[model samples]
Target chain A: MRQNRTAWFFLSPSLIILFIVGLVPFFYILYVGFFDWNAFSLQKGMHYAGLENYRRLVFDQPFINSLLLTFRFAVYAILVQLVIGYVLANLLATDFPGKWFFRVIHTIPLMVAPLAVGATWRLLTIPGFGPVPFYLDRWFDFEYSISANASQAFWTTVIMDVWHWTPFVTLTMLAGLTALPREPLEQALVDGANRLQVFWYVKVPLLRPIILSTVFIRLMDALRTVDEVWMLTGGGPAAATRYTGLYIWRIVFPKTDYGYGSAMSLLTLYFTILISWLLYTAIGQQRRGER
Target chain B: MKKLITLVVLLAVVSGFGLTANAQDDNWWATAAAPYAGVTLHGVSESTPPSNYAADVLAPQFEALTGIKVELEPTSWDQMYDKAIKDMEAGSGIYDFVYIEQDIVFSYLAQDYLVDLTQALVDHPELAAPDFNFDDFTTFIDDFKNAEGHVFGVPMEAFVKIYLYRTDLFGDPEIQAAFEAEYGYPLAPAATHQQHEDIAKFFTEYGEENDLDLWGTTVQAASGHSSSFYEFFESIAPTFGVYNWGINEENWKATVENGGQMNSDAAKEALAWWVSLLQYAPPESTASTWDEVAATFAAGRAAQGWVYGENTAWIASDPDRSQVVGQVGVAIPPLAEGVMEAAEAGTGYVGYYDGGAFGIPHSSKNIEATLLWLQFIGQPSVQPEWAAAGSRIVHDATFDDPLVVEMDAQTNGYYTLLQEQGYLFKGAPAHPFHAQVRSVVEPFIWQAIVGEITAAEALDQAAAAADEEMARLGYGQ
Candidate 1:
């Protein structure tokens, strides 16, 4: 009884904050999704039209297109971040001169805010002013203007995300490497196993849990990404790069369709939760199989 | 420890509320004005010449005359809108007067969020002086007035759509002779839809033949506010005879979908002709915006452009900004055959529509002072002042003034041409659904221009979507 009281006392503040800032507002948004609430006419009583907002989303072409773009962006972002991050992690785990310097430089992109990174990249990609296209044309006899094309926009955003967050994944993996038991790795190395065989058979198997956790966390973070795209193209040339978050902002702020925006937010939240749960379950199953 | 944290959080919240309340009360207009004892008036404007020029020239003059100190707050257009909306919504008396766009007058007036300036006009007759003829103001001002006929604001800057072309490029003897030979007329600024298409085609084909990187014209198809697609559509929608709302003189109900007379054969022909001109525009024109179009023209890449008359001032302000500064000529947008016929039949000239007006927010405590400032700005003396400083003044008397004309001539006759061609004048249909309809039609028009969709397909989709949106908004059947 005494332990239970002590635990409750410690958790009370967090519980209150979670209720006020998170759970309460989230539930409120869900309720708002059932109304026809225009922000411009906030004083007027909202009309209740249950599921109408969802129905509109189901029929809206732009909404569906944005959803597809977001999924594509996420898949590309995860794969690129994982591959680059793992390679960098492996490189850093080696005994090399100037290793600390290289590690520090790798962390530089992560230190800058995503908005600054996006802006810097946008300046670097401008056709006349930027050097990337000019240099590429000189060397490869090819020109690239990603901002003007939809498919290119998707790849550009993915590349930017990889550049910015690969360091984060690398740092996490490095920590996992240091905390890992060295005995098994050393035994495998001494048993006439080659470097690749040792890494693939022993080290990679040990890093599985850490890798899954990092991927899951990064996936969750990437789903709500907005600032980078907002600053770079504002989801344009058309609505080419518009993610669900940008779409929500357009509906809520510019169009003043708060009810519709709420519906979109709820839908995004549901998809994110579902995806995270599936990821967690799959990772758990994989770990069990490995054991 | 928990109690302490809770106490700190509560205190922070309370202090935040207190500070907001205090800040609202501390602003200039909220406090009572010191009568004749040197009152301080707060004014807000964008970083334009008129606003900046007023701060330099007129503020001091007003202060000397009334013993009122005018505090000018200069901001960019985007910042100005954000700050104005925030202050108005909060009922914070930060500004005694604000410069605002005329289109948003409906939103403001509908909310009863502006002071009625009708009494101020009646009381101050001198402000409506020898040259400030209210009768000469555009008929659209009535649309801006409240149900009680209260004039909430005055029209300040007048912007109109005009065609800007490079005289040097078109004046090439060989090209001109060939164009005349082919089209059976001298190739001057296009005066008809057919002529516009022919000229665009000629320039585009010329560039293609020479393997030049230049385009015939730059048509903006960018998404969002200030999209050229909307401007292009507006310029020709009237010529096409398409009323935004169905025209019913007696019943007063919109019947656009029911094949009303307003949606006549003339309107469809006009739209089709305008759509056809997109063929000669740049391939990337569908993604270009107003700024991009302006850049293209300034880069000497485009032979001709359909742009706002205000661009003349923008280009003339900085020599480095334009390659064709002294070489550009202006003309009214082209008309359709039906529009010409209607004009011959004594119908008033139909043209694309635009307006920019000023208003005092309903929450303003200094309504009287704001009205006085509005009237002062619209005075005959001030009209010339604005004109001299390179702003397009709407007052007829200002346009008639010898000094205004001379000032315009000095600026390479840009103002003179703009005034003569009736560039500041507009006659597009006015409906509450103007913004909404533009949002839907702008994108589809862009798609059509880019060859992503056929003109007929674009129109059909636009009309259907517009109809659905109108119905959703309870606008019309």
Candidate 2:
């Protein structure tokens, strides 16, 4: 009883904050999702129209487009980031000259604001003023403008996600690499295993937990990415890069359709929870297998 | 005991300092208005003031006049709207004065979020000049009053969309001769959608041959409100006779379909013409918003660009802002074939849309002070000052002022185009779901422009969606 009381006292502040900022608002948003609420109206009264917001979402073409785009972005971004991060982590674990410099360079993009990075890339991709298109035109003879093409916009967004966040995965895997039990690696090395075999057999297997955790984290971050895409193409040419976050923002701000926004947000929350559950299950399976 | 007393006293002093800092009212609004003396008025703007014209000018001037202090709270356009809506919804008095878009006033008014200014104007008659004729305001300004005939807001500025072109680029003899030979008319700013497309194609082909790397025109195709797509569409809609005439007399619902009266055969043809011009526009135009379009013109890549009247000052004042500042010329948009036929028969409507207005909130504590500020801002004495300082003013008398006329002439006769074209400017319907309708329509219009869907299909989908939304909101139906 004493231990429970002490624990509760220690957690009291966080619990209070969670209730006020998180739980209360979450429930209130759910309540709001039922009504036809416009954010700018003078009337505070909300009429109860149960399930209307959700029903509308089912019929909303744009909302569905945004969801599909988000999923596509997430799949492409996560797979690319994971592979690149793992390779880079393996490279960094070895003794190489200017390793610190390379690591610092890798980390720099992560430190820069995502939106600023997107804007900078946009400036660099402008037809004549930007050097990328100029160089591409000069060398490869391929005249391309990423801002104009929807496919190019999608790829650019993927590349931007990799550039900004692969460092996070690299750092996580690096820690995992450093923390691995040396005995197994030594035993494998002694048992006539080659360097490649040892790495593939021992290091990667042990680093699964860290890689899974990093993937989960990146998955959530990728789901919420709006600022970079917003600054770059703004889901444009025609609804090409509209993410879930941008959709919700349009609802809450421009459309002032908070009820629909909340419904969409609740749906987003459910998806996020499902993703988290899957990650947890995957991690648990990997851990149990290792045991 | 002595140490405990010392600690308590120190804590008290620290808390006192924090409280005092939060309570300080150093702005001009706090010092100027008699009723609001020692009270701070938070003023928010969508854009940062130009270096030559900062809030300090109005802050000090207002303070000296009214003894009230005004604190300037600057934010980006999107952020300002978000904050304004949140504050208004919560009934939080965080902002005493807000600069909002004209289209949004209906939604704000419907909510009773804005104060009625009729009584305030009557009570503060001294604020008005002997020549402070409300009649001087155009019908565009007068139409924004609430249904009860209460003036909720005063017109802050009037901006009409005009076509800006580069005289130097089009003045070349060879290019001019070729254009006239091909189009059977003098090479000039386009006067119709067909003319505009022909000119754009000609310029794009010629410019490419010359290695000039210039576009014939630029239009915004971004995904948000205030995207120039709407303005571009609006400029040609009247020419096509595509207009939201009014609500149905019996139904009281939005009129979008019914053989596309607003979304008519002519409008679709106009849209197709616009889409064809995209080939002449810079490839990046698909992602361009209003700011990007402005930048495209400023960069000297576009031979002609559609822009608002206020942007003329923006281009002229900053050398770094535009490459063809001295060389730019303005003209009213051209009439379409349908409009031309109507004009030949002496029956056509040539109208642009007004952009923004200013209003006091219903929760304002100093109505008289706000009214005074409104009258002062609208005065002929202050109108030219605001215009000269790079903000647009709505008064007709101000346009005739020597300084304003001289400035306009110096900046390539933008004022003349404004006065001629400004009178024809109308506003969109003030229904509550108007904003929602815009959101649904804008995206699909882009889809149509990009050929993801046909114009007719996009219009039908948007109309059906809008109708559903209006019905859901228990409006229009």
Candidate 3:
């Protein structure tokens, strides 16, 4: 009992902080989500809305569209990042001349602020003045205009996210690769297995947990991305890039519809939690089956 | 020696009058702002030319005259509205003054978000500057007034989105001859939609043949920005005889079947015409707001375009900012059939008369100080230089000021047009749900701009969405 009291005492501050910042807001949003409240409407204060916001959200085509778009964007971004990041990590694991320089250069994108990354890409892709279009037109006779083309705008945002975050994936994977036991890798080699076979059969199996963790983290982060995309295209070229986060932002900030935004936010949170559980459960089940 | 003596005496007499006027102005600030001397006023505004003048010039002048400090933050448009609205909603008393854009003032008043400037002055007459004459401001002030005539804001800047063309291109004998040969019309400022289209095509082809890095026109058609929505609904649709975003004020219906013209034949034609111009405009048009449109014109990449008047002064006279400084010309927008007649009869307007005003929020702790700062800026004595610097004329006296007259000449009669025909242009409607309705309606317009949908389909969807949204907001009901 004395030891339990001491542990409780030690955990009290962090618990309080979490309650204040996390639980309080979560509950507050949950409560507010039931009322139709517009922050800008002084005359029409909070009205008992019940599930009206959720009902409307079901038919909110823009929000639904944004969710689908966001899902596709996350799938593409995560898969690409994982593959490129894994390749780069393996390549960097070997010693080479100027390895430190290559590592630093590869990691620079992770250090850049998302806003700066968006802005730099904007300047780099702006037609007439931007060098991207100039070079593309000269080299391949291809016209590159993000503003004029929705497909181009959407892909550019994806490319921008990849550029900004692939380094993070690479670095994490590199750490995991460095920390590998090496016993299995050496054993496979001693058994006359080729390098590729050893890497695919032994090394990958050992690194699966780390890879799964990285994928889970990247998936969550990509789903909620807003700032960089906002800065780049503002979810435009016909909102082809209006992800779930930007859609919620439009509701909460510009429209000032607190109730609807809160409802949407809560729904998104539920979806995220559901998705994480499914992913975790599926991966865990796969590991268990293999065992 | 006799002539020099006479000139010196004349200079001294003029200097004395100025000194006496300065002394009187100083005395008013000293007396009116005495109580609020140590108080600092916090304000937030968009970083436009006029707002910059208020921050960089008038704030310091006010501080010098009255020991009160003014911390004015001029920032991006989105940030300005977001900051101001959030501060007002929270009632945190963080901002003493905020820029109430003409379009959003109705919403602010509906929310009771601002202090009634007229009533505030009436309640505390001591805060009103003696030189601040409300009557000196033009009728544009009517836009900021509630139904009870209680003024909520002091007008800072006012300008129309005028049609700008290249004088050098139009006057070029070779180009004019070539254009006439092709279009079979005397090349001048477009008086009709057909003429504008012809001019656009001619200039584009001409640029290509001559190997010049130029386009025919500039379009404010950013597929994602709100400026494109404003451009279509306010500037272009009005010229096509669709007014007030085609929503019937009485029933608040936006669909044509319900007596609104949002998706009417005229509005569809207008949208089609605007989208077609993209072929002749710079590729940047698809990503442009009013700011990029202005920059594109200033860079001389286009021969003609619709430009906001606030950018006219610098683009026409400041060589450092504009390559076509000496080549710019201003004209009224091309009108559709009966559009001019409708505008003249006060039933419609030609284009957007955009502006903003400084108002004290009800949540402000320093309303009295902020009021003095507003009155100080609203004084007619400061109107000419501010008007000259910002290309905005809010007061009648600014029209006749020598400095403004000189600027008018320099900008090819921009102020003259404003004085004579500003009534033809109108601000946004008194929609208390402006932002809400606009947010719902603009996406369809974006789809049209990006070729995701046709103009008719886009407007049809937009109109239906606007009607449903307004009803949901309890407006039409």
Kindly report the fnat of each predicted structure, to 2 decimals.
0.04, 0.38, 0.62
**Candidate 2's residue-wise lDDT over A1-291, tens digit each?**
999999999999999999999999999998898987875433446767799889989998888889888989999999998889988998999989999999899999889997898788778775545788789888999876664566776888898888888999889988998899999999999999999999789887888898889888888889988988787666665777789998898888777888888999999889888988899899999999978
Backbone clashes, candidate 3: 0
Interface RMSD for every prediction, one decimal?
Answer: 4.6, 3.3, 1.8
CA error at residue A272 for candidate 1, angstroms: 1.8
User: Per-residue error at A172 for model 1, in Å?
Assistant: 3.2
**lDDT by residue for model 3 over B342-376, one digit each (tens)?**
88899888999999999999999999989999999
Arranged by TM-score, best first: 3, 2, 1
Residues B258-354, candidate 1, lDDT per residue (tens digit)?
Answer: 4433334554465566656556765445445555666667666777767655555555444677776566766666665566556445353445444
Model 1 residue B74 CA deviation (Å) reads: 8.0
Candidate 3: TM of chain A? 0.93
Query: What does the lDDT read for residue A17 in candidate 3?
Result: 100
What does the i-RMS of model 3 come to? 1.8
- CA deviation > 4 Å runs, candidate 2: A39-44, A126-129, B1-32, B48-56, B64-67, B123-140, B223-228, B245-262, B316-318, B338-351, B363-372
lDDT per residue (tens digit) for residues A104-163 in model 3: 998999889888988899889886778998899989999998877878888898899998
1 or 2: which has the higher TM-score? 2
Candidate 1, residue A266: lDDT = 94
